[model samples]
Target: MTNSLPEMAEIWQQTLNWQPSDHQQAQFQRLYHLILEGNRQLNLTRITDPQEFWEKHLWDSLRGIALKGEFITSLKEGASVIDIGTGAGFPGIPVTIIAPNCTITLMDSTRKKITFIETVLTELALTNAKTLVARAEEIGQQSKHRQAYDVALIRAVGTASVCAEYTLPLLKQGGLAIIYRGNWTEDETTGLENAVKQLGGVIEAIEKFTTPLSQSIRHCVYLRKVATTAVQFPRATGVPTQKPL
Candidate 1:
């Protein structure tokens, strides 16, 4: 099953207007295998097929930043990034691979998953990334982590309000939070705007795009932090999911 993943260099340029370097391509291939090997011991991810993994995990992760390409590149070299609830390191690992200068924190509440990611890091020699095993609520209130990141990435976590509560608190003023979702609606957008307003952030943009290979609908919500988030946010463990904002 060597080279199970299709090399879609032209497709990437056509869709995202960018393609990975040769080394980045190799790293992506390595990451795929690492995740596959990890699944046997842990329930890291269910999308194991090469094509599925390429579209959902690898391509989809970078697609968010590709939408805000110029703005994301404006972030200083060595910018701090946190991937909250980064299960199996989707988006985080891909971001790390692409942005070699940025320092990425791959955080997940599950210890086994973090352990598996740690191995992936070592195997990939992904020195720019680090793994953290902690909940978003816990870190959002911590002195060292609160308002410490330039970018926060979250995917498939919870509701829009819950995502805002969990991510807005971790971003420095002027920082950006990119939330990935499958399906979105006008009502959801209204609610999300209110939630982020309460958290000292504004909805900068809500980009809807179809996936390159499958043509699946996806949305990338960009929240820009304008002021300090209230201290009550992230609101105790289970509170964000249970009560949201």
Candidate 2:
């Protein structure tokens, strides 16, 4: 808790064309302290340093939605969003802070992680977010979750094709799936295209950028659902990883 988070208003504006309000910034600081406290018992995240957490977790998470100098308009208009495999609530929590109007569900298979996020929600008084302890494959097949969200976010979950399998099925027609990755390739895009097609989606865009602090390369693959995914999609539990797409 000694290392306080930086305001970095200029950096935020220059990088993402947006900056957190004072209340949101305070919530971000509180979230950081909660994560550090939770890490002692739970191993929540390795990036404990304030600057690193700000750059990698806070800034990096928000950057995924800031395309072409605009935050996705749907987010401001109260869209329903689900963050698949949201371990320790990276993009979802940051997103919930920024997009206060949108309703967010943070899904993770681990109950402990979900429990930690619930604590974060309560401590931050974030009324717009909720936590779900469930597998991606299971939720994608469930009636309540299938084709339910306007935006589906995933990061560091799996391969591109596998990510497509997990997210595409849960999105409504015309919904978007944002898959975050590091070190992308043309071969990977080809593989992803095939997978997304089978799941009733198309590759909308592939954005590449450099991390602000470390200057590391990152990619966000956007898939837009144009048709209903086959009922067989997402496969059985453990199947997406075992035999992706």
Candidate 3:
């Protein structure tokens, strides 16, 4: 049986004040097929059910960056974006399909996953996106990649502090990082504030929303880079997650 994702146009408009264009919708469908095929060999993702995949993987991924409809606008103006630890291309592929004007780099530590995403990009005919095989720690320090992105996206990667450390070092001044989380707490926010500050970033906003399909609580923490990060940032490999700022 071929699982088909729901084309909930009304829900997309109601929740995000946006709807996918015809080409984008078709691209999403093709992406679903590619991912399912890739899964057979690569263990791509656990979300195979169509509706569940639509809600959790596609919707949740976009929601992190869709603050009051700003994400769409930014992409329209051709922003540079990066997805750190983009397992199976979660938000990155969806964003690449929806925002054809923006350039997207999907970065992951695993060579096989990046290899799979490279296929996904080619199959989707996505010219504005690319794949990177490297850990966030190493990429954050590279002179070519450091402070190079206008937006950074991370989800299910690590603790908020570690996410901050990984993301902030790669953002240009005034760039934004969207950290996706399932549940959030004020205490966690307090801790994140200190961590972001140490990385030359500040908490711009934290939005809490419920999933339209499952009513699951979710949070998106927005961090803005206000100054240049110290060169010592991102530490060594595994340092961010082990010691976290």
Candidate 4:
């Protein structure tokens, strides 16, 4: 098995029109090692092979936050970001490494996972990133975290509507939520539309793309928070998944 992530600079430039600096490259490589090590004690992730790790975990994570040629401007402008259910800190950690200006909070209900991420952040010396041990439903009701972020990211966490419920209440009006998925359909879009609208968000755009290496289908649903979410949101822990929107 390959044990090292390839420094695919050309792939980065060709696909996202963005390239990591030498320091960022080193950080990415280090991140790969750390996740592999952490996987032994925790069921962190199954994508342990280096090449697969780079494409699925690193590139795919960053792709969700970018457009054709540029990253979301808010990220460059020191946006406050929250990654709901950040199990292994894919996009949040990578986003923190590349866009040091943004402040990212990696939240997960599992304490062990958050503890592992805390170690990763410390070892990486990522001052801009922090870890949170809490459920999205509970955090959305907390005054300190509610509507405090400019952008919210969620991947492999739950359904699109569940992701919206977990992320929307934690964002300020006009904040953006990126929902990452392996596949999407028109029926899913219709369900998501109603769910988001009720959560005070609008379906801004949906992007469909394939990974550079695996060529697997992927979708990113971008929702813009247009109004204040109702206080009842997040509807108690596990309720979002059980009852959904």
TM-score of 4: 0.98
**Where does candidate 4 stray beyond 4 Å?**
none
Q: Model 4 residue 221 lDDT? A: 92
| RMSD (CA, angstroms), candidate 3 | 1.1
Better of 1 and 2 by TM-score: 2
Candidate 4, residues 185-243, lDDT tens digits: the string is 99999999999989999999999999999999999999999999999997998899999
* Predicted structure 3: clash tally: 0
The collision pairs in model 2 are none
After superposition of all CA atoms, the RMSD between model 4 and the true structure is: 1.3
CA lDDT of 101 in candidate 3? 86
What are the candidates' C-alpha RMSDs?
1.4, 0.9, 1.1, 1.3
Q: Per-residue lDDT of 1-245 in model 2, one digit per residue for the tens?
A: 58789999998998878889999999999999999999998978899999999989998899898777578888989999999889989899999999989999999999999999999999999999988999999988899999999999999998999999999999999999999898899999899889999999999999999988889999999999999999999899889898976
Give the TM-score (vs. native) of candidate 1: 0.96
Ten contiguous residues minimizing lDDT sum, candidate 3: 68-77
Clashes of each: 0, 0, 0, 0
**In model 1, what are the clashing residue pairs, if there are any?**
none
Clashing pairs in 3: none
Consecutive 10-residue window with the lowest summed lDDT within model 1: 67-76
